[model samples]
Target: MRRVAVIGTGVIGASWAAHFLAHGLDVVASDPAPGAEARLRADVAAIWPTLAPIDGASPDRLTFTADAAEAVADADFVQENGPEREEVKDALFAVLDTAARPEVVLASSSSGLLPSVIARGCPEHPERVVIGHPFNPPHLIPLVEVVPGEKTAEKTVETAMAFYAGVGKRPIRLRQELPGHVANRLQAALWQEAYSLVERGVATVADIDTAITHGPGLRWAVLGPFLTQHLSGGPGGIAHVLEHLGPPTEAWWRDLGQVTLTRELVETLVAGVDEELAGIDRAELVAHRDAVLTALLAAKARTELP
Candidate 1:
């Protein structure tokens, strides 16, 4: 079994470690936080039952350390999930550069930082470092975007995709990097409208959420947006959508609310969310989200994809 090193033990980081471990891959996790060791142990144990179903129902395999270098010493792959700060990532990369095996592939769990920025820290492994970003709660959401930097080798991209696939993630190789990468760019597009609705007092946060979770979000759970659009067009396909609903959608796009981060707006948004979430405890919400996501993934696994 391949040994994977996880360099951070926070939410997204810990999820990666749990998925790796639960799939029966040997894992060595490291985090500088005071109680990160205990946190990771508890996290992996808790996430295993949900995560194990990805690879087949089985027991987990995980080990952790506070020593970053020790964790990557002999690892076949190193997944860096350190703080988003460049300096912190640079420092972590420096340690990983020394500890990891010569040919071991290294990937960042960064949401937006360019791989080129991360490459600055590990000169020797410049060809090996690439962005292996995942959707939130990665073990449940399987999309892994493999983004290669300007200096990144073609072989590096190939290797990274293979690695993610071997681990059962649905990896997509990005041709180039743009702001927010692919998935987040699509999400930002949607959020622009969500924000607009709230700003116009047309909908509350909860109402906007209800609109998606009950509407497109449910369908998206089974099919991608493009495919859904194609189906929505009926026999005429995309042409039919353009002939009918396209004009209205374009008008809505033109009228989208502007982006601003004023304090009042922030407060309003927060208060609205607080009111909307009054009955649901934060911990309980997380549990519900994970459960629903698990069930959705299991259901999707049974579909016949085209």
Candidate 2:
């Protein structure tokens, strides 16, 4: 798409606008919140340097409006990142539906909400409503889950996939709708165990962080869990690895804990993180993370990993 309408200038929306601009698309973003335009511009400016914008790509191409309808007036595609509540989504999509062209695809950056609920806002052409969920900062992360609702047209899916891929994103299409999609669900599985560990006093928060960052996290950065496990099997591959490790793995699964984040647990988790980050400046930590992530992405780009 030559022009993308970002219908919320929050973190995710701003990041998506920056990403689209870096890929040479014109971006028009809208958010009703006070100072949203200025904040969006600043956010885009901060993220621009990391993008290495392509030819014809420039922050100058970004535009802002307080009205979502105005933002999508001439956009070829729309990426919605408004509030996550179902009512808000339905109402917002209704506005987008009325303002945007009939054929233009409207994509939501919702992490867990169903596209069907999002489509409910669009009476004219609910088929154009789809989910284009992205992880945290879209400017850096590549994963975009392109999910279609019950009424979403096959053509809309194809267009969303193509548009996302064209902008240098790694887009995956879900065969059916599911809460939290796939990646987030995978993350939740690990998070659940991590929280359980903390609640049970099995490991300190800092130690748990170390266990992942120095161990499996390092491997996971290069490949997903399945591929990493395949390598763990050596020449025997995943099948052989499963044969040898399946029993213990199943037992461990059976032992895995289920947890509820009660008030006490929340406080404990927050306190643990505070302790872990003691003496570390939050800004510096984020900068270091961004720098390292950029390098990692570059390294992966030069490799043949999937």
Candidate 3:
């Protein structure tokens, strides 16, 4: 798309604006919050450096507006990043659906909310609304879950997928809707065990973070869990791993921890994170993470693994 409208210029919205601008698209953004324009501009400026070297991007084409309608009135595509509240999103989508051109595809960056519910207010043209959920820091991350509601048109889904792919994103089409979608569900499962370990005093927060980042997280960056397990099977691959360890793996799954975030557990988690992050600036940590992620993606791109 040559011109894109970004509704809700929050962190996610701004990141998307940066990404689209990096792809050489003119971006018009709108958010009602006080000083939103300044924050959006700052965020895009901060992220532009990282995006620039990859695709020769610049921020000269970015513009901000206080009116959401004006932002989407003549845009080719609309990326809505409104608050996660259902009532808020439903109302926002109605406004967007009414303002945008009938053929313009409007996508939500909702993390877990259903597209069906988000589009329910726009029965007149629900077909054009779909969920295009992106992981945190959308400009740096590549995964975008493209979920179509029951009423969403097949053509709309295709257009959303193509749009994200054209903007240098990895778009996964989800056939069914589930709360938390795919990645967040996987994350919840892992975090359940992580919290249980901390609750049981088996490991500290720092230890757990280190274990993942220094160990499996490193491999996970290149290959997912299934492939990692397949590689672990030596000559036989995944079938062998399953044949030999399937029963034990099943047993382990049965024994995996389930945790409720009670007050005490919450306090423990808070204390642990506070201690872990003591004396460190969060911005510095984020910068370090993005730097390493950039290098990792570059390295993975240069290598071919089965």
Model 3 over residues 1-306: C-alpha lDDT tens digits?
799999998889998999999898999999999999999999988998887533445687888899988999999999999999999987888888889999999999999998888889686799999999998889889999999988999999999999999988999999898888889999999999999999999999999999999999888877889899889999999999999999999999998888999999999999999999997888998899889878877787689565
The number of the candidate with the highest TM-score is 2
Query: TM-score of model 3 relative to the true fold?
Result: 0.96
Clashing pairs for predicted structure model 1, backbone only:
none
Tell me which residue pairs clash in candidate 3.
none
Q: What TM-score would you give candidate 2 relative to the actual structure?
A: 0.98
| Shift of residue 83 alpha carbon in model 3, Å | 0.7
Q: Candidates' TM-scores?
A: 0.94, 0.98, 0.96
Considering only N, C-alpha and C atoms within 3 Å, which residue pairs clash in candidate 2? none
Q: Best candidate per lDDT, number?
A: 2
Sort the predicted structures by TM-score, highest score first.
Answer: 2, 3, 1
Pick the winner on lDDT between candidates 1 and 3.
Answer: 3
Residues 1-306, model 1: lDDT tens digits: 478999898998889987887666788888889999888888777877676544542334577789999999989888989889889888888888877887887899899888888888887778888999998898888999999988888888998899899888999988988657899988988887787788889999999989999999988877789889989999999789988999999997788888676787788789889998998998798889999988877878877576
Question: How many times do residue backbones clash in model 3?
Answer: 0
For each predicted model, how many residue pairs clash, with residues at least 3 apart or on different chains?
Answer: 0, 0, 0
Off by over 4 Å in 2: none
lDDT of all the models against the reference?
0.85, 0.92, 0.90
The residue-by-residue lDDT of candidate 2 on 180-222, one tens digit each, is 9999999899999999999999998999999999999999988
